[model samples]
Target: MWTEGQDTCISLGVMVCVVLLTGMARVLVRRHTRSTFIRVFVAELLATFQLCCCSHELQVLNELRPDTPSWTLTVIYFLSLVHGLTLVGAVSNPCGVLEQLALEQMPVWLGFLKIFAQMFSSGLSRTFMVWVWSLGISSRHFAERSIKCASPIHIALPEAFLVEMLCSFIFHSTVMHFQEVRLKFRIHMQAALITFLVFAGGNLTGAIFNPALALSLHLQCFHELFYNYLIVYCLAPSLGIMLMVLMFIHFLPWLHNMNRIHKNE
Candidate 1:
């Protein structure tokens, strides 16, 4: 028989798979719905649920695994790779929707609706995770291990906020840069950068730069109006993404100018 930790990991893995596949199925089934919002909503909701499960499972495994430093980092890299490839609809990120809004590529009303759908779906997913944990602990023999929140132990709130802001800014800039790169490299680049940032700042801000997940998860830990959730998770990411877009806009011409100078010389 497997150890309790091992069993819990297996169960969590299964849960993540189920939720992610459900989301993907929504993408496939979109033809029947004929409603863009509904399809997007289902995909976002289920995909973010899968993300939460993966995050929680990572937490559980790091504690149970041998030489957590090595195993955890590897798992983080694998998860990031899976995330970039699977979540094709840009599920559960209000900041991504905001980026679209800033670019004037999406209608304001549609963006707001997407954000609302994301939040609602995240809440449902979080609730499902919590409920599963509660039932598993009480009803099962091998699923007795504990779940952990990403606690900012040593860092100050302001520092954590700054870390989140910088992380988000870098993330959005990378997204913009990736758009210009070939698709072959984009997913790997996404995995590498996402894993890097999570490894660097996960302890401080749960490494969750996604506002929808932040609102669903962290809001449960802190008070309703807590700065930790608002400033770091919500506001900082939006501001960071906005700034990234602005900087990209203002400097885009410099790239052509530099190329022209190089050719002339």
Candidate 2:
């Protein structure tokens, strides 16, 4: 059995390798690809792959050291911040791509491509992680590989759906509202919000607000029915993003106009 320190180092090494390799791949793609579609596809694929690998590693580390909630929170926040800063020109979340489609900011075909890239990358990450664990570099990795699938959902299906929906709503709303904010500050705000959501909803549904991310981490688990995972993780988060977009585009302006008319009257 590896010591805790060795486990931590191995996890960190894995994350670092993923980040570096993704960065290199992205740079190569950008240099060689003139097609916008190809560039976007490569970007989305590498960014989402990096995200899923790091997130899965962190989750395994959390399980290994379950007693250190504060440590886990700190690491999550730091990783979120890193992702927000680094994922330039890439929409790693399928929900974000759908939101752009709804707003007509992205072509339908491009949005579909982005979503496909995200999902494909998610599956790749899952496979990659399984292979990494199979190497058994650390005792924790071996133990995690041997463990049977367990459901993250602890509540009823409806409640779990609501939890995921609320988390997605809050996250995307923040993203919408922070568009005018400076990048340095906006990324911090986003990271803080993600950290808070994960902390608050960690026990239920794994606080996964991204459909692609949920697919990568939980879709294959045997403890939950396929439909149940779809309802709570995939459908709910997408609906939440759509709801936020509708409110921002229509309801909020209508409410503001009504309030102004009442004041004028």
Candidate 3:
């Protein structure tokens, strides 16, 4: 068995390598490409790939060291912050792309392209992480490689759906509200909110609020029906985003106008 220290070092090395390579790619793409579409595509793919690979590695660490909740939460917060800071001009989540589409901030074709890039990178990340595990740099990784895929949901389907939905709602709502906030503070707030949501709902549903992320981390698991994953992981988060858009973009403004009319009357 590999030592704990070795496992930690290997996991950190993998994450650092992912970030460095993807970061470099993004820089090169930005420097070389004048087309906004190509730049966005490359950014989305590389950013989502980096996010998924690090997340998958952390999930392995969580499984291998189940007792280390603090470590897991800390790492999640740090990586979320890093992602928020580095993923400029990239929507790494399909849900975010759809939200932009819903609000007319992005054109239909561009949204579709972004979603495609997110999903393709998500799947690619899964394969890459599996190969990393197969290398068996540590006993933890070796053991993780042989483990059968299992569903993350530990509650009833309805409850699991609600957990994911609520998590997504809160997260997207915060993102909307943070639009005017300065970038430095906004990144920290976003990261803190993600860490909090993960802590709150992690036990029940793994608190994954991104459809692309759920696809990467849970879609292949065997313990649940495929439809079940669709309901809780995919549909619920999308619904949450829809609700947020409706409230923020449509309902609230209409309500305010109605109230003002009543006051005038």
> What TM-scores do the predictions have?
0.82, 0.95, 0.95
> What C-alpha lDDT values do all the predictions have?
0.70, 0.87, 0.87
Candidate 1 regions with alpha-carbon error over 4 angstroms: 1-5, 19-24, 137-150, 182-184, 251-265
Candidate 1 lDDT, 1-265, residue by residue in tens = 5575666566556556655676667657775788777776676666676776666555656656645666677777777777777777654688988988888988898888778878886777666656666655422322233233335424777887788889889988888777877665787888788888977887666677887777555544546447666777788888888888877875667787889999999
- What pairs collide in candidate 1? none
Q: RMSD, model 1, all Cα superposed?
A: 4.1
Descending-TM-score candidate ranking: 3, 2, 1
Model 3 steric clash pairs:
none
The candidate, 1 or 2, that scores higher on lDDT is 2
**Candidate 1, position 16, lDDT:** 65
Per-residue alpha-carbon lDDT of candidate 3 for residues 1-265, written as tens digits (9 for 90 to 100): 6787788878888898999989898878878899988887888999899999998888767875789898899999999988988887888998888789998998899999999999999889988888888887777675355246667789999999999999989999998998999999999999999999999999999999888888888655623478888889889999999999999899999999999999999
Ranking by lDDT: 2, 3, 1
lDDT of 3 at 97: 87
